[model samples]
Target: MSVDVEGKSLVDLLDMLEPAPVPEPISMVPQTWGWSVLALILAGLIILGVYAFLRHRQFNAYRREALIELAASDNNAAKVAEILRRTALVAYPRRKVAALHGKEWTNFLNQTSDNVTFTDGAGRQLVEAPYRDVKADPDLEILARNWIKSHKRERTA
Candidate 1:
């Protein structure tokens, strides 16, 4: 069975039909201002954290150098003493550290560190080891390494 289109042509039928709706293109940009603001804040925080980490590493570079020198000294007491002196010079004022020697130097070492004692402990080697013919004590190297790693910075005021 078929219905007859007596008066209409194919072109006329096509033109009479409604056009299909076109959907709006989805936006790539964020819909809200708050989302954009949050993204910027997150980027800024990431940059700040990276900067702080790099500065911390740079500030502690002296400690890393001193430790390397200590390892290369091979338990030579004179070399160890020189390394400790040089490290102290970098950590403290030149005037305060440059003139210290013998017992004063040992006392300064003890004062700066909370855990290690240079006066009566293995650190005493620093005082007399360089001048005397005494054999190098392994403990002296360990003590120096500990002091170099953990010694507190001097207060500026």
Candidate 2:
């Protein structure tokens, strides 16, 4: 069943209708310039933070290597002393560290580290270990590891 348009032609029917209202298209980009600038700054800061973290890890790679060598020394005093000296050379100037020996070396270790163990404590064994038949002292190993972990780096002018 249909209602017939008695007087209207197809062109007349088309002319009688109006166009539907169209909505504005939504934008995916941020609308405000401030928001865009803030987003760029935040992204740049994140990138900078990641770069700094990676550089810090790379700078401290020597510490990781020294710790590994310390672990592998098997509590041998001479080996522990050598490892500590090599680690010191990496952290300090070659002229200052390479020439250090005996009590002078122990004093230098004490000066660089937080604890005084290197001067009078278990670390004294480092001075004698290389020169004489010294027993492997676990405390000396611990002291050497502590020094390696805690020693301050020399400041460059």
Candidate 3:
């Protein structure tokens, strides 16, 4: 029998197989529209999450600010009175404590200051001034101011 000349056998040459070719990636964007719908759903969820977070933060911040103001303030009751007045201002934008006079003003004031007695005449109007008017009683102003410290209601506290 004749021997192989170089070295490796014919068996080694036949044992090796060719490597498989890599497949190209298919483009889903051009083929199907489902990806766009999924993207829109994700975007909507993101927007909703952001809006909720912002609103919660705003509410917390408002509560914190109110607490800080109350802590620093010497008068708590009067602060509550002012807060109520501000609420009323938002509720009824047309007639404010300053612009309103007579029975209308008294009725508005009565809601906040429950203890004070009022007459049909200039009773309510007398105490309607923001900065102590001649007709408005100074003692009543002091009473309202004192009440501010007592009436302040905080969410956190």
Candidate 4:
């Protein structure tokens, strides 16, 4: 069991042993780009959503101002009528709203906003309320504000 190896050279001993196998170099991370592409797409969608929200707020900026003015005004009837007229003028042509009188004006208001009937409901007060000493319907104020906030503009040629 005790063999002598004093005469053997280091190269002969190394040549006698088997060589260690060389491993192929490998990358730890996968090569797929789907995750980065998905992240970029998600970021783009969020940016587009925020931009759409800001644009919508800008488009309805006038409604917010009118509501605030309506809330702060002392003369409810005159202010309500004025706000409606001004809003109509902005939405429609001047000729359409300029000469409307009494019931016709109320009817126009109702047509513009299908949610409330201005002619038959509390909005009828707007006809004579501005000219004479008349008490404005408290409900009309709420209805008008809601209409102004939610009314969709009609396209006129």
Best by lDDT: 1
Model 2, position 54: C-alpha lDDT score = 100
Question: On residues 1-157, what C-alpha lDDT tens digit does candidate 2 reach at each position?
Answer: 5645679899988876779999999998999899999999999999999999998798778988989988998788888888988999989999999999999999898889877467766777888888766667788878887888788988765
Which digits, one per residue and each the tens of the lDDT, describe model 1 over residues 20-88? 999999999999999999999999999999999998798789999999999998788888998999899
Q: Give the TM-score of candidate 2.
A: 0.77
Which 10 successive residues of model 3 have the least lDDT summed?
Answer: 148-157
Q: Please provide, for model 4 over 77-115, each residue's C-alpha lDDT reduced to its tens digit, 9 standing for 90 to 100.
A: 777888877877776789888999898988787777768
Model 4: lDDT equals 0.79
| lDDT of all predictions | 0.88, 0.85, 0.50, 0.79
Q: Can you tell me which runs of candidate 1 are displaced by over 4 Å?
A: 1-29, 133-135, 155-157
Error of 2 at 77 (Å): 0.3
Provide the clash count, candidate 2.
0
Which pairs in model 1 have colliding backbones? Answer: none
**Model 4 weakest 10-residue run by lDDT:** 128-137
The CA root-mean-square deviation of candidate 4, after full C-alpha superposition on the true structure, stands at 8.6
Per-structure clash totals for the candidates: 0, 0, 14, 0
State TM-scores per candidate. 0.76, 0.77, 0.35, 0.71
Model 1, residue 55: distance off in Å is 1.0
Ranking by lDDT: 1, 2, 4, 3
